[model samples]
Target: MNKFPNKIFDIVQEDLMAVEKELYSIIQSPVNLVNDISVHLVQAGGKRLRPALYLLCARGGNPDPSSELLPMAVAIELIHMATLVHDDVIDNADTRRGRPTANARWGNHSSVLTGDYLWAKAFSAIATGAKQNMLKILTDVISNMCEGEIIQLQEAFNAEQDEADYRLRVAQKTADFIAASCELGALTGGMDNRDVMQVREYGYAIGMAFQITDDILDITASAEQLGKPVGNDLRQGIVTLPAIYALKTSTHREELRRIIVNQNMSNDDVRRGLEILYETDAVEYSYTQVSKYLQHARNSLPITLNGPVREALLSIADFVGLRKY
Candidate 1:
């Protein structure tokens, strides 16, 4: 198969410079320490997809893009980055986006502090200028995000977890920000409630697909490609979709059971469990499920959107599930 860096990748490359500058402009800080830590992570590079989603949704509503969209973009990214840094600490991960994780580079204390700072900045941006309704939406979104993460932690290694539970977890953890980002963008576009809700649903579907694909790739993608070992979720005692499906069909269900339920599995035991997962079609099955969501996302797009900007957002939903990075 051809690699993922093609036309859609080119679109992101073309827009990245403007997006980067916009992010830099709003994330400024008088506190040198906070600025230093926050800038380090920001500069490290992310796909900028969350912020881009905001911009794209704005463009879709009105053909003209706005500089006013900058702070919102920056705010969304700051919130996203903060969550990631905190997640690395929670996961005890060493790398992100193929670079050393903030937690790894700056120690847990700095990582946590920096993450908190980002959260504060993101909230401040929303409270200061954005519409009150948008701010309220974001506040609720962040709270839901925290709830999702906590739920994931609670369900970790609970192999009895079902697909519905998996979908709910991802909806709360990953889809909320995505949905909010699109809604904020549409609001910025000056769209009415109905249009905003439709776009938000589109974003939510994309986010759900994105997270499900992520879970599948955690089992199927290689370390060089993933920036960490496959099965990182399993290592952290989180049983993802593949594991859940695999265990159902696993001939060695008892072995898998002992490891997941009892806890404290050796690295070798986890490795063997992963092998069993691969041997089954669990990864393939999950990918099939993700594809269905992606299709739903595409179908959910409003017919009103018809141009390069809308196409770009659609391309992104198509890209995320299949991309190597």
Candidate 2:
């Protein structure tokens, strides 16, 4: 995949290739329908950022986290892919990564089953001699993710959903999962409990920044850059950080709120909403939030974290802060 280049990826390029191999193996099955759908899911590209984060954290303390820890990275990525697939169904998304979504090509029923299978495979991989402590991390993230999704459903299209409300959903839906990936990686890397917690905190900050950046890009980025249409989240009635800021501060609050709350967004409505967002400091405010969290992620690292691993973590923060796609 053609993700933005970074120094951190070079550090784990070989390990990342191994992860891709294992992921391909897991997507295979006896059923032709399952196999075809799984292949499509694989073809729908992703940068595999979650697994790369895991491998980097594992390398932080350990001298060498060998093939033994490879499965953990694969498992983490599987869970991530599962969520994206299921989310497409929920959103009725036609395309992802510039290609037809699984639910679009096949059907929602098959797509949902494939997503369920991915979740099962994730747990199965974790069960393969993984410690209970590691398993607990996965289970906790899953629980939090479910809670976040439920809250998102309850809050969708409600213009009253404030910054605090948006953050609550973000903490559980996205940040929590990234935290689990880091924590699990550090645990496998044989770090002490104290260090693992610190790494998890770093992941938490970066996760928030990464997700918030995604929200900003949804509005400010072009369709060519994002591989999808702009203002998609707003059209779906999912009020994002920038939109929330605009709603609270912009003079056109009533018009914006009407479009969002009514949930009947046309191309013209989307254009009008974008006009309001740009008139305010919503995008700039969102950028400030992303920068703040990235700085926090950097500060969370202990003094002892150094060498190639430390540089990698720092580079990840920079990438998250500056990436356009």
Candidate 3:
């Protein structure tokens, strides 16, 4: 019942609630620890944007829920959840969505295994009835995500990274899964091949914009809004779009370099770094890039695709552009 920025969610409120139930049902494990950790992660809460997008696409063909869509939706969400738990372990993050992370509460060992269990469960859900192609898509997404994380680890604090490097990383780390979600949704929705391609492109563009906006918010939004520490990426030496732009454009490039390379920046240093980023207008520059991708996302949608679902998709696109958290 929580208000979402995208009106489409409100329109599909009942279906999303169903997805929430399915998510819980699918992740139930016989192992008490696995069940406890997975349940805690689910309770932590996320927008469920990935599954929502899937359901929207599926509804286009099968307005009344199909057996195929629910399992796919559950699988997508579980994959996303697995990433979050593992990401927390990698970052040594203590909190997520304003709750203690699995790693934080259960220790890294348990958390890693819990994350693995989630991954296994995700694939199991998919294997139940999904097509071979769908399995291939999911496998490729997992590979890309791992490669993205490895690339990010390799590039940490490397201020020399360019837009291409960032884009590739974003595509692997975030956009591919979103693209897969839309593609699979369209496929399940009985959309034609061309239309499915269009939706997939739209998902990819929006996914890029989503991550760029998230990176911007990491520097601009408060910790409470983020449900994680502000400037956490910078603190961890994970240079994002704003930092990349600031490195290229800011007058304080040398200072930024020193702080970033040291990788042990103090709070005051982060404050000053943010100031430099602001002065350099890196945030606004990133926003411009987000706008470019948003434009692409809109253009990718077929003009012939009309009605509430189409409108909802457009609305979600706009929401991505304007979202703060």
Better of 2 and 3 by lDDT: 2
Query: Listing every candidate in turn, what is its Cα RMSD in Å to the true structure after a full C-alpha superposition?
Result: 2.7, 1.5, 1.9
| Better by TM-score, candidate 3 or 2 | 2
Candidate 3 ranges beyond 4 A from true positions: 1-3, 62-67
Which portions of model 2 show Cα errors greater than 4 Å?
1-6, 63-67
Whole-model lDDT values for every prediction: 0.79, 0.87, 0.86
Kindly list the per-residue Cα lDDT of model 1 for residues 1-325, writing each as its tens digit: 1234445545335445566776676667787766777778888776677887887788677633434666677788889988998999998999876778877887999889889888887777666568778888888999999999999999887878887888898999998789899989888887777888888998998898888888877877788788877778887778788888878888877787667765677788778888888788897898888888888888877777777867777788778767654
lDDT (10s digit) by residue, model 2, range 181-263? 88888888788888889999999999999899999998998887887888888888888999999999999999999988876
Return the candidate ranking by TM-score, descending. 2, 3, 1
The model with the greatest lDDT is 2
- Show pairs that collide, candidate 2: none
Tell me each candidate's TM-score. 0.91, 0.96, 0.95
- TM-score of structure candidate 3: 0.95
lDDT: worst 10-residue window of model 2: 60-69
TM-score head-to-head 1 vs 2, winner: 2
**Candidate 3 lDDT, tens digit per residue, 126-212?**
787898887888899889999999999999878888889999999999998899998888888878889889989989998999999
> At residue 219, what lDDT does model 2 achieve?
90
